[model samples]
Target chain A: DNCRCAQCVNQDTLQRNFDTFAIPKDLSPQEISPKNDGVDVLWSDSHKSHYPWSWLSLTLRDISHKKLANQEKLWGATIASAPPEVRFDDVMSSTSPKGLADLTSKIRQYGLCFVTDSPKTPEATEKLLETIGPIRNTHYGGFYDFIPDLALADTAYTNLALPAHTDTTYFTEPAGLQAFHLLSHTPPANKPADEVLGGQSLLVDGFHAAETLRKESPGDFEILRKVKLPWHASGNQGVAIAPDMAYPVIETNGGNLHRIRWNNDDRGVVPTDIDVDAWYQAARKWDEILKSKESEFWFQLEPGRVLIFDNWRVLHGRSAFEGLRRICGAYISRDDFISRWKMTNFPREDVIASNMQLR
Target chain B: DNCRCAQCVNQDTLQRNFDTFAIPKDLSPQEISPKNDGVDVLWSDSHKSHYPWSWLSLTLRDISHKKLANQEKLWGATIASAPPEVRFDDVMSSTSPKGLADLTSKIRQYGLCFVTDSPKTPEATEKLLETIGPIRNTHYGGFYDFIPDLALADTAYTNLALPAHTDTTYFTEPAGLQAFHLLSHTPPANKPADEVLGGQSLLVDGFHAAETLRKESPGDFEILRKVKLPWHASGNQGVAIAPDMAYPVIETNGGNLHRIRWNNDDRGVVPTDIDVDAWYQAARKWDEILKSKESEFWFQLEPGRVLIFDNWRVLHGRSAFEGLRRICGAYISRDDFISRWKMTNFPREDVIASNMQLR
Candidate 1:
């Protein structure tokens, strides 16, 4: 008979051979006692075994099929009632462990979340970023103010309607977390009634939309998954930046959605080898889902309200506004967000035990 | 007796129980014949086993402990000798598979390689990059001309002596392959006999140096590998760029060295928490090894010659010179280089067979 101790079982093969009765009945522990960091057990065959708390916890978690803390909770329009939000004072005062854990959990659940009652200043955003990690400075400086400047390099600088899309698609590794805080908004005097009606911020659950397409039309999803598209960003005139990157619009790892990169303005000329007609058809369908009322969540950001979202999984846009509006924001890297998550939300014994099963 | 057919043998456990006598003597093949893709064994028991040539080849290669094509070969000054080089004419006309294969082999063996007899033009370098993959356009643009332009954003634009270091350390993912083609070189008029001295290109095998440190001073090596250091690159005046990154000087995966990033000028202020004395001591030792004659290979680049090197593995520098040197080059991503290598040097059946043993 093979040794049926916890350490003897090959972790890799355990999953494939998993059964409720995989733990042999003949090897059931006769006496079990908890030790300082583990448990000591006497088996029916008189074999003694010691299992660490971590290992036992992880095993039990795996057996229960519970999801890890970081795995995203998918959502769509039906669940997109009010945008996930927390009080600014709560996060600002989250120096205590419990407070920070709550804030991090909120951000993790909803790709986008809001903090109300934030100070209407660029420095406030910088301070908020430091609570998590350092600012990820790109061509755009850290904690930059966004005002309508025709001379600016990016389209965001103008008061033009932008379709829902991720930012910095041209970057090799696009920015992860993006925060936008409206510092001030002044409705233009003598503005046409129609002009003032459209400046609401728009957000779409890209992962949800991708999953819908994958389930409804596998053919179109396959085409998008297999094709690579180019992205380019000419540095603002006199701003030494000329960034370019190429990747699939819908990126996946092991068939799980990883990221979504879609910026029409920054898209480079498509390669001649790809089937242009088919690609356009597939892309149009994706755009339809992105813009559909069933997929989009809209809100008009007011002064001192900060909106933070996962740039990799959420597409954000702004409607054209005929007014003097001022906003400030900063980009944070994915690695930093993950690091902060781990620091603030220490994995419980159960989660660690579950991961051990996969080891 | 249990069946001893090839299919019945657990491939994963075969290596652990490997023995020539393990095969049943009574099941000796009555006839062995080679098929189009595999060998068919007609056992005395009337059972047939077909083994694919790929699987057999991979198994034998693995048994012999051969390194994969992509794994690098480390070298020091004693073996530096001449940088691996090929004729530009040969590479340019390498439409034939064999010609391209040989060129790729040279690059794989030595992280750096040169091509002589290249046309002394900026377009020539661009053409060479296309053979591998599309150019990786960054702030410098694709196939940039490198002249001593004071108006430029980077320090490479100045004729000052540059210390041995990797380029674009501030990037989250730095450029992979960097190519330099000297288009023209004009020594300054009335140059002193001793002043004509500078401008010899310097190269250091970072992997070699790192390995050496790991052998001689494990403590310092561990510190360099484990600690994260910051890198920064501010854009030139009015140029919109804000570059920042943090990573270890020596990066590794599963204990194997992956990449190296060392740029003194762009280094950010060290974090306050680390042991300052210990870190500086370790960093100083690392610098010494990089500058030592035993670790460096020097050469004078000339027109009609191109130098291509793995940017992640090699540290390049230039001595101060009073001359008008015109150079042009471009960056290629690591993915592209690997793709070209795989396309040109298709592993033989035996190699594939050997790898199958692992699976």
Candidate 2:
């Protein structure tokens, strides 16, 4: 009942409002302050005392395209908006025999998918992970509640704004795929009571951006060899996760894009090697493209809906909003997802076919 | 007249006062107050407030090899206490023409020579850099007068204790050979009268330890790839230098031993990957051998003594003591040294024969 795909929302009707949006340059983090200006997290204690104000000049701008929907030939942006329909494997009464098969297919095809009619707690998320397989922990900060935390103001425990970036860009093998379910979020601070409020989640395909970086500047990409950027997430005592040593944020292996930690809140400092500066610039340029508004998208993920995404190709972030917002996440390896999909004869093409007619 | 080689300082006549020693794990920075321990110059102001301890742990162990003189097998260690001799071109005018060629041959054969009765000043060392063709700032960290202001102590410009390590470990393409002159150093702190009492220097053949690491445990030697240890030196504005990246503390390349940084101070956290852990264990195992009293050669430098050695195969540090220690350094690319040595028919076996004799 919640899906409003081509058949449900009548794709033809919204196809009129379907002008592709540009990718966003900046990602609105869950919330830095209850008021929404900034955040103060655990590392903030060390961050505030050691770094100078000169380092605060942040530059995150958008460069997303608006020429066509991602599905368009050659010019499409992303096929990862709300799915066109609910896929089913309804043979067994115990589970959506087709549901597992369909969910696996959607992730394989579009790199991400939304789930509805599920519990919204961390415990439920963990249970869901059991059904899916193994989940790797790649969260930079936490199993984000995404909901605003009013208790810890800018005291380092309070959250803050973050730049849009890939996760674990510094690791030799980064964790793949991410799932987030919002349990609670207070509405934004300044919104009008009657205004149509929403928390739009944003996803950028890093796989595509890596290709763009390669095509435009191979020499620049090679700069990653001499560079070692810093990243940190040791704000709290309970959790301190980041690569053990300095590592590159952008990596290329056999033409495939591999990323390490890219969350700005976790970054320490950029290296001083001149050879490395160019690659950081290249990474920034690629990020700028993802920042474009036209290349971005969203569908309100209300409770009972869980979105599973390929952590490698697809980058994720959230929109500024009012209302209590909460999201819990779990991770699984790519091999697991691929095997799950192959077990069901790969029905990604079928779902695309059914949705194509509705469009 | 400056150098005191085998004939100059024998076991029976050796000044048994100074010996080789290791750095301890809990020593405080000799320059900074306990209050600003973690107050590194590169960190944001806010970040420094939390960490009260300096990021570094220092030790001061002696490095004299007089004890090995009896073992002909340790002829290499016998010369550890050899005095360094330096010669200045203009200053040599008063001497016989035979002096120039004789000293040049000594340098070519021994890889180091002592020049005495030469102009002794910071500028004299700076001039040596100019004569060497080009001076490469391996690390962007600006050169400081050995007598840096006390306030600049917070900026890595003071009488600080350095860890046992080599230079250019952080460099992907390191400078070749270097010369650091004692430009300005006053007496030791508190022990104002003890100013001239201490401040001896230490040097070890990176070639020596590297060969040992290779022969003893090649598996541990390969662990460096997994342990891209963290390092930082950003006293200079807009500069963050990492002294250990691609090169290992002990490496074997082209049938020759190569080493970069040796100080555990700059080499921060070890990587978390299993391979990294394994490599860490291997390097540590080899280090046990490297730290053995038998393998090290140590000595101190007198003014006007230009100590030149291959940065690729030498690890150097200091035995911190009374008064402030000051030194000026100039670097020459290994390529230039090689080119010049080859052009002049400088016997490759002579200019700087390895102290690494088969023992």
Top-TM-score structure, candidate number: 1
* lDDT (10s digit) by residue, model 1, range A63-157: 41244446677776665566677777777784566555556667777787888788878888778766655566544555688778755556677
TM-score of each: 0.48, 0.38
Off by over 4 Å in 1: A1-67, A78-80, A189-197, A238-245, A348-359, B1-311, B315-359
**Listed models, DockQ each:** 0.02, 0.01
Query: Considering summed lDDT, which 10 consecutive residues are worst modelled in model 2 chain B?
Result: B58-67
**lDDT (Cα, tens digit) per residue for candidate 2, span B1-359:** 10113322222212111111111223233332234433332122121222223112210111111211111111234566664354577325444434444443344444445565545676666655444333543222223345545433122243444334565443433545667677555664566553464556666555556556666776766664224443333232222333212234554333433344554433433433346447546656655655566655566666766666666555566655556657776665454444343323333222111110101
Quality of candidate 2's docking, in CAPRI categories? incorrect
- How far residue B86's Cα lies from its native spot in candidate 1, in Å, is 26
Most DockQ-accurate candidate: 1
lDDT comparing candidate 2 with the true structure: 0.44
